[model samples]
Target chain A: MKIGQFEKINDFEWRLPRETQPGMRVPVVVFASERMLNEALQDRSLEQAANAAALPGLRGNVCVMPDVHQGYGFPIGGVAAADYETGVISPGAIGYDINCGVRLLCSTLPLQDVKTAITDFTAALYHACPSGVGGRGIVALKARELKAVCEQGSGWALKNGYATAGDIETTEDSGCMEGADMEAVSSRALERGVDQAGSLGAGNHFIEIDLVAEVFDSAAALAMGIHQGNLALQIHSGSRGFGHQICTDFVQKFQTVARKYQIDLPDRELVCAPLKSPEGQQYLAAMRCAANYAFCNRQLLGHSARMVFERFFPGAHLLNVYDLAHNIGKIESHQFGGEKINVCVHRKGATRAFGPDHPALPARFQKTGQPVLVPGSMGTESWVLAGTAAAMEKSCGSCSHGAGRVLSRTQAKHQIRGDELRSRLMAEGIYVQAGSLGGLAEEAPQAYKDINAVIACIEGAGLGRRIARLTPLAVIKG
Target chain B: MDANRPFSGFAEVPHTADIALDVFAPNLEELFINAAKGLYHILGIRKGTKEVENIHISMVAEDREGLMVSLLNELLFHAANNQAGEFISLEINEYQLEADLLMLEKTGQQKEVKAATFNDLVIVQDAEGFHTRIVFDV
Candidate 1:
């Protein structure tokens, strides 16, 4: 049922009345095209966005990007900000795959070179990088060493000869966010992660070899090292079991403290406590650790891919385009309704798209803005976009993470066969590797809302501007 | 007698098993306990063959949807690692959910824990029997 209180601001924007729900100190907004909106309203995401507005110390409107969908507490593609002092932190908002995100690498080789080695290259990647359900990589760590990874993040990979220095520079937050505490992570989480490093865990995580099918912003693309038909690799993964266990641990443990702190919520999934509370602080600390683990996981995997490329091309050069996290929370200063305030921004299934001149941006891209890497489902078109000033004024510089799931896994499995799907991709000149057909079917191209539509909404809503479009030539699914 | 028996998400005529146990309650505590019982029931853990231990576990997700993915993973870990066949009921009155786990082992030996995926469980809302099913690697 519609909440009856929201005002349709435009074809792509809607605003929730602050008074529509009790405990809601701020309004909530959603950005979606008509098509996306129709699909999103079918689930509980909009209601969850409203519920997020009810959280204490919420400043600015709780915002939902075009890819909004049903999730635990905060809807995936939902963004909210809380007062750092009075606000609360909930692990649900950061997600199980903490820092589950995407990274893009630009290769100098053109389509000629890539296609020549296409099958062999894909097979090499499948062999070099571990993927599929419970996939494991080449490196394994024990207890003490795993702690170092959780604590130091991508730097750990750099020091251990897994990732290079340039790689660290190109990643968001240099692939490590501050405030990670290994002590906050449980032994079980550590155990799960030690063997998971450099691996791609299942469920929508993928490594795609793509060709720059089109470049809309030529100058920007040139600056970022792109040529039409050039080869690029995209890695999509996250903290894996480590992040999962941490989020699971906190969600079940935070309940008592939420009640003790008298935090009111419309759903049990939204349970949270004051940001400075013992429970909240602990979650943040642990969340950072997971986020860092994810950064390292991707870094290690990328390094492995780079090695394979180097071995194959021998003379080819590659450079990291960028790495960005889709799920995370951070303290940032923003102008909310004219007042500059410090708030904790929670982005779940949403990408941070900080515009030009944002102090947090790398000195080089500060003029061009952050590179938002949106990985489409395998056998589809991914995108590269840049943050804009419009986003800075709108949803705290955020955009949709990907083409949101259109069909549930059960439905997808019923609709498609893995072998058929693989054959179809191969017919289109795409090479595909997957651990399970059931998994491949579940993440079939048809299962996701149109990625082009999602990107158009982001552009239409002024959150980000398109730069380049990538079409997968080969894919690795975990 | 049939009505009183706990309805497993599995073992239904249709033979499903995402949500193996469906119990009713007017309060929160009972809902959690029944949920735990439902999980153990699916693993086929029985009474008296094992000892119950206080097992502390937790999970987080971007939202509740992801929570289910993490929660089942923990239960699967215990079942695989510690031979925890059934997780005993406990107080869920607080905002957080808590419980004790019971492990059944023929002898102390290493067990393989194959990770659980979202595909393993099915959840459907129903009045008669909440249908469910799970397939373990072992």
Candidate 2:
């Protein structure tokens, strides 16, 4: 696995042809600059992407984004589609936290109006948004109630007065997947889900308040309710323990099932079962339950955030911008080889950036394309982009999630002490609320690659169009 | 704290987006116990002053790797879902692990690890007895 072995498709695209890997069924198309590609070569991201290409009945080339990094079995920014009839669905490929995604909410208040209230506002947000390690959620639900949440997603949030009507409309799949089977979820997973319904779990998840720093395209930015100097909130969370348990249960189950089907996987973590198999259906049902749970989870957090804004600034209001999932396996129809075919697209650290006019997009966004939320690492410029028609033909309607980690937790700690990092960030006018200083150290901005460059690569690869850039003013992390 | 002292069984390993731990123990039982302690350490579990009762946990896996994941996940389950319990003792065989977790009031937990992943996970025996690497999704 070397950069020299890859064929440069363009400035932002590289390819490891089928001949480059032993069992690769299709080529591994990497969307990155030469520098980013070299960085990816330092890890096993390309190798994992090739392994993903080796999966059974894979349709399109395994696509790796510019912000690529080594993940468990597949590259973090890898996207692969497998035939619905003959493909395989692996829990490992979809990641442990199902539907771990980001939501952007633009506020009516401007930063200058709230500048003096940031400290109190951030503290209020931290208090309202229950975060950190211990409790994943504040609302405890009974088995029956939990089942309803799993089925209805953000709808349950709306019924419970935790979400607005516009919130559901702006969310992916309207914040609920249709096929979530309550019976498919295990008791252990349900127990894990009970207490963590509206909580923000630790590790890379956060709540950030930012102002629309720079607008690349005012039309698209206005379409997304992102205006320069306006406050926007980014809620990055997932299904919490609920999704983790679902993935854990399925990954463990698929271990034996993969052997049962005699699937020759390069890595054990890449273990999978046929998409049409009993095991696959069971996992998909359970996964959808987790996905829906995540959708509801973020909505509840949004409710908490809204409460903070209302309490802090009397007239502050918010409108849901967009909510999108970064890690998921979805059955979608795509133009493949001149035919419309159904394929299960597995996105681990990738996002669905369906182009404008895509039938699946919400009516309001059809003209502007789906809003792509890329919340960069703490204290950096996050991005809001629009999915393009070019993305649909190239990268399976996918784009980079964010600036992927470049340093390990231990390495990050060795580089800077958490308290010092916090103080430094505070001195720079960025309010910080973290559960643990050590945890904060691991998420330092330098631990990640250059996000602006990653976004540029995404644009260069024609996966997305620049819309708005956000600069962090305050952050609450668990 | 004395009971926890002199117990250097595992060390934190570097992972990009998750928590990874490397456990080294003389046998299967120690490996299981050390792995649990490693997870609790990562979670920053704080034990209460008084113990209430003994909670028994049992898990079975097809292999050592699976067994290790099950035991760690079992600890995570109790940590996340249950209001009480800190692992105090662990006993293990080839394929099964049994442990007694102490439950008490006012127990505090800092981090909740979601699950143990099988990504590049392996338990290999060597001259140092047995060593294993586990990745946790937080």
Q: Report the error of model 1 at residue A7, Å.
A: 1.6
Query: What fraction of the true interface does each of the listed models get right, in terms of native contacts kept?
Result: 0.00, 0.65
Best by lDDT: 2
What C-alpha lDDT does candidate 2 achieve relative to the native structure? 0.87
TM-scores for the candidates = 0.85, 0.95
DockQ of 1: 0.11
DockQ score of each predicted structure, in the order shown: 0.11, 0.57
Which CAPRI tier for candidate 2?
Answer: medium
In model 1, what is the error at residue A184, expressed in angstroms? 1.7
Instruction: Report the TM-score of the second chain of model 1 against its true counterpart.
Output: 0.47
DockQ-based CAPRI category assigned to the predicted complex of candidate 1: incorrect
lDDT of 1 by residue, A1-478 (tens): 3734558888788888888877777888889876677678786677778877888888888999988876655788999988898888877676767898998998998887557797898899988998754546668988877878878889899999988887888788888888888878888788777788888876678899999999998887876676778899999988877787787677667756778898877766567778988778888889988988889999988999999998988888667889889989888888888888888889999999999998887776777788898878778899999999988788988888898876665567788998999999999989998877767887899988888899889988999998899999998886
Residue range B1-138, candidate 2, lDDT tens digits: 455333339999887766789888777777777887788788787776776677888877788788777767766766664445666777767777777878765377766677787777788877667788888776
After superposition, candidate 2 runs with Cα above 4 Å error: A136-138, B1-8, B82-94, B98-106
TM-score of 1: 0.85
lDDT of the structure predicted as candidate 1: 0.75
